[model samples]
Target: MELWFTEEHTKDVRFTIRVDEQIESVQSDFQKIDVFQTPEFGKVLVIDGYIMLTEKDEFVYHEMITHVPMSVNPNIKKILVIGAGDGGTVRELTRYNTVERIDMVEIDKMVVDVCVDHIPQTACKLSHEKVNLYFEDGLKFVKTKENEYDLIIVDSTDPVGPGMELFTVDFYENCFKALKEDGILVNQHESPYYAREAAAMQRAHEKIKKVFPVAKVYQAHIPTYGSGHWLFGFASKKYDPINHMDEEAWNKLLIKTKYYNSALHKGAFALPNYVLEMLEQNI
Candidate 1:
């Protein structure tokens, strides 16, 4: 018998990966966490049967989320990250010497523990000096903050279970209030390839647009995610991701990346016509 891990992308579509063995599986207070070893993707982290990250292509999602805002405003020193329990986001942000403090709010502590025990590659930087971990609700965490952080990254899961509130208008409003003047907000916007997912993507964009002065969507290709095409939300009070990008200064940092660069940073925001129409028409 062959061991495999399968995820249902939709009612009719499913993705399966050949698994060598199950390394760990523990039921956390929030959700079920599992780690598996695979030939194609190496070590994989699963939350509630959803693929969170894999050692093989984790760089693409983590790097794009961190570098896109960092390149636009290299002076950003204080960052507030929500729901990034895997520590991949912090790992990339800690690479910047200029980033002084990172306050990460995660609702599930077991998710962090499981990742640290099984996938040390991404979880290594969770203990860095600049990082401060707070295991609480991200929605409530931002509510207590007011114009403090220079950047805020909403590295949340899909709009369900523990992450559903992160997509609401109230949460986005609190996020806007928690950022300093000219601060930036980036989030894991859902994919636009499927009907259900696309509806959620459009809803999130609409809510952010109501709160922030500038709101835009960007794209990235991550194979494990549904449809292999994912989107991210970029909202800011003052700076424009394209016009204000400090490409020269960012390049000077000499930060080596596997999937992100200055060129791709500018091109990611250039969405396809259908996606553009969906955003404009609210379809």
Candidate 2:
């Protein structure tokens, strides 16, 4: 018999993948986590029946989220990652030798453990010397921190379950306060294709725009995510992802990437007219 896993991307749309085996399944304190082996995507990680990352296409999301902001402001040193338990974000950050400290606050320890055991491609750098892992609520963690980190990457799940608060205005306000004057905040801005996801994406963009001096959205093509077109929020106190981006400096580092390149960096911010109109709506 063939094994297949399906997720409801919308009430009418569904995504299915052929699975080789169910490697692990566990009910954590927050949500259900599952790991699967598949031929097309390699190791797949799912949370609450939503696809998070797959080994084959994971580089797109991870590199786009990390390198975009890093390239814009190469002086970034201290970093905080909220809710990225798979360690993919930190894995990319470790490649930057100029980065001094990396603090990852993931509420679900099981996600980290399972990913490290089953998906080492994305989780291999969790134990890096510069990384300090904290198993705590990211919302509360940012509250205690004020003007501490140079960058904060909100690598959260969708705006539901435990991640609901991360999308609120209060949380974005706290994130703004947690960063230095020159700090940057990059978040998992949901896709703009589906209705439900688009609303959340617009709301997040509006909130961040209100709080930060500079707020913009960028797109990436990740086949596993809903609608396959994903957006990431780039907000900063001083830097503009496009105008301030030091393409020459970033190229000088010779950082090899699979999905993100300096040329694409400028192109990603050129949002589609529909997406731009959606973002422009006064919600």
Candidate 3:
């Protein structure tokens, strides 16, 4: 089997895998879901045929997505996870005892069922008693909820198909409404190396900043994502990531981490000069 990942100029990525002679869709039950097994990366999870996460490097995505905001505020009791079907974010969220309730709103139940059945390594923590599974639209869920969470993590896939609404300004406003006074929000923003899509991410950062006072953009490295460089949208009411680094708590939280430690957490924010310039210009 020969596998190739190509970054299309259309701002959408495509991964092609040829097994033996011809390529056939392995898992196609879900409308836009595509699951594939890779030699190096283990199981690759995709939605609408867009690659979301791979087994080998999923820790980087999950850790940065879940830990960055959680470590900043050690008091996040109730958390809302939007669009994390594979349970990677749930796994990371469960690490902290303070996280009592996780309202996971994923529209596609098939993604959760498939991952629960197939990807035990990633989905193990979603089965925890603290999680409240909501098989409904995240947009609608956010609209109805109020002052329920200390942290809201937007773990949605690329802004397409079922996840398109998750990227809208209306959704961010609802996230602001659903959060407590000192609530914080983080979303898996796309890659910076990919210019057009990165521009879209920059616009997203702009849109989020409009609703959340302490909105900022951060970075992470995940091998499965294009360019291996990812962005995270940080939105908060009072907490600031730069001023609120809890070194002791961060160290304490790292005893069980493989992909995220104090060093990696610190290094994730060290962006290149050009990227920094872009963010500055956007700001």
Candidate 4:
């Protein structure tokens, strides 16, 4: 027997999920993480009631999330990842030869331990020599460091539980201070159709706009996340997402991708009228 999850992303598209018996399940005092065997997405990790990652669709999120900034800033060396307990972001970040070190700050040690032990499909990157792991709050760890990183990627879980604080204005300011003048920050901004989630994204974007000279919202479509369409918040000081893409670098470094390409890179930034309206009206 199998199960499925589906929703219409747009008038032209519908996202679907089909799953078999669970491959793995972990319940902590704070949350429950489940990995299920899925036909379309291979193995999917669900934390609490939210879809965290799917082996099949993971590349779309991880690659787009990691590559967009790196493609813009070529010299990024010291990378900081917040709340990516499973190491998928680190895995993608390592693909960049310029990334010499990765400091992954995660709030839950249990999540790290569980992923390292059971979710190798997504957690395999932690074993790499370049990654330095820390079990601390993403907000607090970022405060002590100032102008130290070239890139910071926040692979935070959906805003809930310990992940709640990572979405605040204070956290964005701390990240700005912790980043080098040229450093860039990118984080999951969640879905657009769900009003509550959309407002959260807008609020976060507004805060980032206040502190960072360059703050933009880009989106991707993932089957597991609500409404399939998802958005990411980008904040930077010296790099412009619109002006910074190096065609030679992106095309050369291109990996096998089911979604996300140089074309989508440009297309993704072409926000629909409503998004533009939000970006403008709110500012």
Q: What is the lDDT of candidate 3?
A: 0.79
Cα error, residue 17 of model 2, in Å, equals 0.6
Residue 8 of model 3: what lDDT? 46
lDDT of 3 by residue, 1-283 (tens): 3655433435465545432221223443435655666666777766655667778888888888888887889888999999899999998888888778999999888888878877777899887999999988899999998888899999887776677898899999999999999999999878778776687687777788889889777787776666777888788999887678686886776547767676666777778887777766653
lDDT of 4 by residue, 194-250 (tens): 766777677777788998998888988876777777898778987888688776777
Highest lDDT model number: 2
Q: Candidate 4, which segments miss by more than 4 Å at Cα?
A: 1-18, 254-256
Instruction: Give the candidates in order of lDDT, highest first.
Output: 2, 1, 4, 3
Model 1's alpha-carbon lDDT is: 0.95
lDDT of 2 at 128: 98
TM-score of each model, in listed order: 0.99, 0.99, 0.89, 0.90
Once fitted onto the true fold, the runs of candidate 1 whose alpha carbons sit more than 4 angstroms away are: none
Give each prediction's root-mean-square deviation over alpha carbons: 0.8, 0.6, 2.9, 3.2
